[model samples]
Target: MSKPISMSRRKWAAAWAVLCAAGLALTAALDASSARDQQPEKSVSAECDKYIADIETQLAKAKQEGTEDGVVALAGVHAGPENDDCSDAFRDRFGGDE
Candidate 1:
């Protein structure tokens, strides 16, 4: 006659399969989240570009004719480590209000 299988062994095998499936699911979720987080911040940069452009155009016009409007534009121009003033001015002149 054949011997019967042990209950403890069967339970352990089931538990192990469940744990592995859970681990795989967790890994996939984390990878998806990381990918989402890596997307470039394009909108914020685009808005800032518009502001910078306005300032630059004003500066250029001021250079050409020394007008008060140019001076005001210069005041509104964003100047710092993160923006290009000249490009910003060009964008502003082309209608980048935000």
Candidate 2:
């Protein structure tokens, strides 16, 4: 008669399979989480580009007016709103403010 396989070998094989499945699940979860984090960065970058483009368009319009007052007004607009780094950078770049 043939002998049955040992219980220890059967248990070991089952445990190995379970461990591999758990590892694969963890890896997939981490990859999905990472993908989610990157989406916001991409959207913010697109929004920043839009803001810059709008500013440039306004500057061009102001330039076409061809008056000192118009230029000064455009400079004020370019300085942007108060209490923001974007405005600060705009002022610094165009020599509007500190």
Candidate 3:
């Protein structure tokens, strides 16, 4: 037969169990909070379309001006380090300089 658990031992065991359950709940809550925070941007196509339109407008204005600055302007946008929503589509339509 097993030895009977003392009163103090039973109380300690119950406290330990409560602490473990609380820790697990805290971990799960933090995980869910992070997942919610990291939700992806929606309507990617709409954002990309607007970006492309702006780029094309700039390109058209440059073309109409008929100046050397037109080439510089186009090159500046093409060679930009930052990539926006339309970057891939723009790259596919017009080859990347690098």
Candidate 4:
């Protein structure tokens, strides 16, 4: 029983819907970019075995201390030695945290 919408009004409504969708998409993209920028990337150049070994050591220590969060809350290392330097330089470049 209601009156039908005019062509202009329908077009306006469609345009409004499109604008809203675009706004939402833009907002989502900005949010994603912000999140990516906020988090520091973990880039360890050390061998995979060594990297995992360090994590395992942290896990073991956390387990002993009854604090699982310890390992889970570890900050990712941004810079690390690419190759294993087992000589005297090893201690200087690589930390002995593990």
Candidate 5:
């Protein structure tokens, strides 16, 4: 007859299986996150487009009103990190005129 597994060996086997499953799960999650990070900058959301449009409208109004201060303030906002994608979208839409 085949020898039965001892208690210690059974415990070791269960622990090894658990570790392997955990490792696989962690690897899959990391891969998915990296895949999202690799997406192109041009894949901005609708919200980003709307934000850029709002900035454009405000800038046009500032220019029309001859408010240099308003234009400078808006420029700072447009240069912020959160607006990077929106600004890229705006530039692409406007044929890089800005």
Candidate 6:
């Protein structure tokens, strides 16, 4: 049979349990706070989607034309006012000049 745990050992075990519980609580609180602090993700707009499609078309045409300069220019196209609302989306999809 296993010997009964000593009083000092019981105290130490209790202290360790409390410390672990406190650490878990602290981690949970930090995770919750960080989630609240983060900005919400933006959804891509229809205008931006259309803008991207146009860019893709241009890129395809540039490839067909076999003009390296035209292809490069289209590759680095920036988002304009027509689709400014989804500038971030454009940047993510095609990378922006900025």
The numbered model that scores best in TM-score is 6
Query: Per-residue lDDT of 51-83 in model 3, one digit per residue for the tens?
Result: 667767776777788742554233333333344
Q: What is the alpha-carbon lDDT for the whole of candidate 5?
A: 0.73
Q: Write the per-residue lDDT of candidate 6 for residues 1-98, one digit (tens) a residue.
A: 99996678889999999999999999999999999999887766775677678877777787788863564333434557655657777578768552
C-alpha positional error of residue 88 in candidate 5 after TM-score superposition, expressed in Å: 17
Count of clashes, each model: 4, 0, 0, 0, 0, 0
Off by over 4 Å in 4: 1-7, 41-98
Q: lDDT value for candidate 4?
A: 0.62
Q: Between 1 and 6, whose lDDT is larger?
A: 6
- Candidate 6, residue 94: Cα displacement in angstroms equals 7.9
Q: Please state the error at residue 58 of candidate 6 in Å.
A: 13
lDDT of 2 at 23: 100
Candidate 1 per-residue lDDT, tens place, 1-98, comes to 99997679879999999999999999999999999989463333665666556666666777788563533524454567565644444554555542
Query: How far does residue 53 in candidate 5 sit from its true spot (Å)?
Result: 32
Ranked candidates (TM-score, high to low): 6, 3, 1, 2, 5, 4
Candidate 4: residue 26 Cα off by (Å): 0.2
In candidate 6, which residue ranges exceed 4 Å CA deviation? 1-7, 43-45, 51-87, 90-98
lDDT tens string, model 2, 1-98? 99987678879999999999999999999999998878332122344445657766766776777632443333333333432555544454566531
Better of 2 and 6 by TM-score: 6
Which structure is stronger by lDDT: 1 or 2?
1
Give the clash total for candidate 5.
0
lDDT, candidate 4, 1-98, per-residue tens: 99996678889999999999999999999999999888463444355446556767777888899986553443443344544332223344345754
Q: Give model 1 RMSD, 1 decimal.
A: 12.9
Candidate 3 structure, TM-score to reference: 0.40
TM-score of each: 0.35, 0.35, 0.40, 0.34, 0.35, 0.49
lDDT of 5 by residue, 35-59 (tens): 9989575687677766667777877
* Consecutive 10-residue window with the lowest summed lDDT within model 1: 68-77
User: In model 5, where do residues sit more than 4 Å from their true spots?
Assistant: 1-7, 41-98
Residue pairs with colliding backbones in model 6 are: none
TM-score of 4: 0.34
lDDT of each structure? Answer: 0.65, 0.60, 0.66, 0.62, 0.73, 0.73
